[model samples]
Target: MTSTRSVAACVLSTGMAALLWATGLASPASAVQAVIVVGTPSATCANPQHPTIQDGVDAADAGDTIRVCPGTYNEAVNVTKSLVFRGAQAGVDARSGRTNPARESVVQPPGASTGFTVASGVSNVTIDGFTIQDSEADGINTLSAGSGFTISNNIVTGNRIGINFRSPGTTSTDSRIRRNRIVDNNNSLPAGGSGVFLGGGQGTDNLSITQNRFGGHVNADVNTQGVLGGGDPAEALTIASNTSVDSATFLVLINANNPRVQSNRISKGPAEPSGSAMLVDANTDGAQILGNQITGGQGTGIRVAALFGPDPSTNMRVTRNTIRSRTDGVLVEALDSGTFSSNIVENSTANGIQVDPAVAPVTPLLFSSNISRFNAVWDARDQTSGGGTAGTANTWRGNVCPKDSPDGICR
Candidate 1:
């Protein structure tokens, strides 16, 4: 067995330098240092660390701790010190996001980009529990600039761009890209595989992407997002409890500033013309789409668009979601205002909750206790007198549409 993991990494390299001096990454004058085992012998550490986890991160020092262990590892790392590269017992039960699969820790890296380059003055780094599969590009990359990063519990699959916090023109603050799994990333086009592509060039601050699990890919917008925000706004962004299946176009695509998409779990697999599964296109001054459970989509399951213009999306809150869609399951057109409550729109091919027909002094859309059934037509639609947004004024109370065709709009 590869010489019993190289004699269990030379007897765990003398007990990993006394467990790296009781997990403090030992540096108190090296406290009798002597590690660097690499493949088998349970990997190992110490002696400024090595045995390839990038040569113990080029001989770790800045608060060292390069554990690694189990097996596979092809090489493509760059990470510039400031360490904490685990994998040995990974996650240790941090919600069992993996690890202990025979001491896991893979990192394939066959041709090129191959994972881990975390550039630009690498700050407070911490990449835990590895798997990071077939990557031709992006699997934990930060092109330029860095900040306190804590990318946790990993698995990240076939990549093209699975976690690319593209720090193009600077700005990458307090990061915490949490609990990961990220499936079939960018299966090569359909927005080219983005399961977390914070593209906002000069953006991001206090970012916290929670419990992740983005979908499998073969094309459902081809994993266009599981979290693909970045066009500047993000100031204390927090996308909660993530989970997606077929993922098409979005499972959270932000233009943050008061962003907080809570209790996530968007179903939808076997791809399709899947477009919406939450796309807060231009959140300005207001945001919060709570308690999610959106179903399949072709258009809206939560698409509040304004196309990133003069802060178009003003005052928002689409609550208690359960949305299912073919089109409008909550499609608040061109912003201007928001407030839809206790939602539960089912089988909609059209309008389950749509307040479109823009242009006007329109800023008072408040539909309450929502509940639209088998929608085919108007379970709730305020196309504001349809004639080109004439003085749009929508205010429906206690909604429950599709009873009498178009009688007083789902009362």
Candidate 2:
């Protein structure tokens, strides 16, 4: 149980100790401590040592390192205070001059649920390098918003919800969910099993879901929808450089505000009855959908519209994206304001760009500087209401179509 295995970080030095000590790692008052967990160690893994991971966490101080050796910790670790639960190969080797990868230790719950939960009121906690699986609920549930969490380099699979960021009533939480392999969280029952779910009612500030693999045997890879509660909308959510494939519903379903959905590879696979590669719903205040490569098979490749919602989809900039779809390449409807420009839309059977404002008097949109081709239907269409009277003042400027037959409000 005490055999050395490859892991995440390294021991802090003199300068580093001072910084982390103020941050509560290693100081004269808050000494840097290590609690080791072996399968069958002589001394019980308590504050300084314990046999179980949870025991070490419960006994340790606010700033301690529970260095678990390579063994299947058959229990859920509930982290209350700010601590680091790393594996044997968690840190770097200063003597060897090589960075060792984090321990691929297994953390399957023995009796309770969830692998590692950063409990409420706990900030600056890190859950790195563990194989967390088979939970009745979420794998790692950051129970509420307004807390800080850094979850990196872990394999989270076979749970009802992978990483559930439940934020209620517009609280601001800072989180970084990067470099994790979140997969195969299958829940046939309704309202479960999303790879990364950002629940409604609250706002997540300084959120970064970047460079993660979110696909394979999941319902929705990433689903983000927050309500317009008393607090302000989520500011600066960055979902970039992730690869999502074979998702049953919505590779990236974003109904949040001011999100930067850039440089993601999304494929709307599995062919569910109702789904899309991407969806930006009516509640979007301002969004930048740029530089993405979306391959569609069943539903719309990129849909920016609302259905019977009061909120206006305004100030969106959808540019530099390559959308290929069986349905509309870029569907915009029921909006008050937006701009779609410099995009390459290709369709095999549907329209490349379909602008249909189902609202009264037609919420005006600008379709400009785009290229549409190879669509069976119209290359660029505007099926707004009332022939021309209702769909007035909507501008279609400098667009290039192969057939040269532009429809509705194209001047």
Candidate 3:
């Protein structure tokens, strides 16, 4: 298995040419990029140029590198240039029961401000390896319309929102957020904050958020909303291989286009009854929810519904997910033209897999190769116009379950 740091390095290298082009630099060979050092002088970062991180950033060129030494920087760092900001132990996760206080770089911003602010129109910036906490706002806030940012290997906690991409329009494109520990950002719970919030915009395109550990968020671990004033949909947004625990909601995708959510471990939803482990709704089309391990709390394990509007979810492919819940395992409402296959749902207090009849049409939906059992009510229940598998408009085949509503649907 490849390490996350190696993978991030490879991904960063792939975008090097684009970064050079975006900065209007001739080439890596031609550009005279300098390296500025911050904090006290050391063996690795000798002859420190700037005493503070913001001073180093302000003095550097667009493509320069800023190396910060191990120290606590109690100030907000505003990044307006496309530079690489590397801290001590950059691209390394030191939260695996290792306490290296002498080798850690920490940033704690005061008042209602962010720790790191990647200003609007600044692209190709890399922020790696820092413990950013105790901010009234986000730990890292990327303003609208920036692209090609690589944020990795940081521990962001005790903020309102850990990492926020506040795109209003002309969305941020081709950014990567990976290998970070984003936890306990529930300080602004009354205002509904999240670990990572992708705000409303033209919707962020080609944004890859993967391999992060998230916990104790008030709203959700990962939350995305589509175009605010209605423009293009968010395309190719991938959320994969994340472990999210003890959040109000694990993942929530609203109106995303063809999003791929794969190989995530989601556990312990909020204590509230309305919380869900995963929710893909609000006319989100072509969503692929695959190969996830989910353990629910008081709410459903997986829910697909247009709770905010009347538009139904369409063309969703939910496959090979294992879910165990205190409430319903899977509850789908206001969906159309989807396939639910090869799922293992069990030990639910309510129905294992239920398609609600009260909402919009769930027709042309295929339920096949599923194993649902040990639910308190019916294992599989589709309360559509038809009574059973033979009469319903939806197709059901090769489902192994103990009990089903309107019978003859389970084999």
* Per-candidate clash tally: 8, 20, 0
**Which stretches in model 2 have alpha-carbon errors above 4 Å?**
1-30, 33-35, 38-48, 88-103, 110-112, 166-173, 226-232, 250-255, 268-274, 307-309, 359-363, 385-393, 403-411
Report the lDDT of model 3 for residue 179: 90
Q: Which 10-residue span in candidate 1 carries the lowest summed lDDT?
A: 1-10
TM agreement with the true structure for every prediction: 0.37, 0.80, 0.88
- lDDT for model 2: 0.67
Mind giving the per-residue lDDT tens digits that candidate 2 earns over 1-411? 332223435666888887887888654643445444544442322223467777777777776766776556778888888887775434321112222233346777753377887777677677776667777777887764435677777777788878877533334456788877787776434556688877645656677888887776445777765344424566668889887777755444344678888998877543644456777775677788889887766677777666424575677888898987657687765666777888998864678877664633234566778888888887877656443322444667788876433343333
Candidate 1 lDDT, 1-411, residue by residue in tens: 011111223334778889988898876543223233355553243222244688767765575666777777888888886677777545742334464455577887766465787767777788887877777776777646677778788877788767776432225457787777777776456444666776535555577778877776543311212223345555666778877777665544445567677888877743454677776665454787888887875777887765644456667888898877657788766676778888898887877777666623246667777888887877776666432222336666667776423356556
Candidate 3 structure lDDT:
0.81
Which of candidates 2 and 3 is the stronger one according to lDDT? 3
Off by over 4 Å in 3: 1-29, 42-45, 166-173, 226-230, 269-274, 386-390
lDDT of each: 0.66, 0.67, 0.81
Residue-wise C-alpha lDDT for candidate 3, range 1-411, written one tens digit per residue: 111111122234647867777989744444467777788777755767788999888888798888889988999999989999898979796335326656778898987889999887888889988888888888998855678889899888899888887433334447888999888887655654588888746677778889999888868888875343324567778999999888778888887779999999988854643578898777688999999998867778889988765677789999999998758998988787789999999999889999888644555788999999999998999887654366665788999988987587789
lDDT of 3 at 219: 83
**Reference-based TM-score, model 2:** 0.80
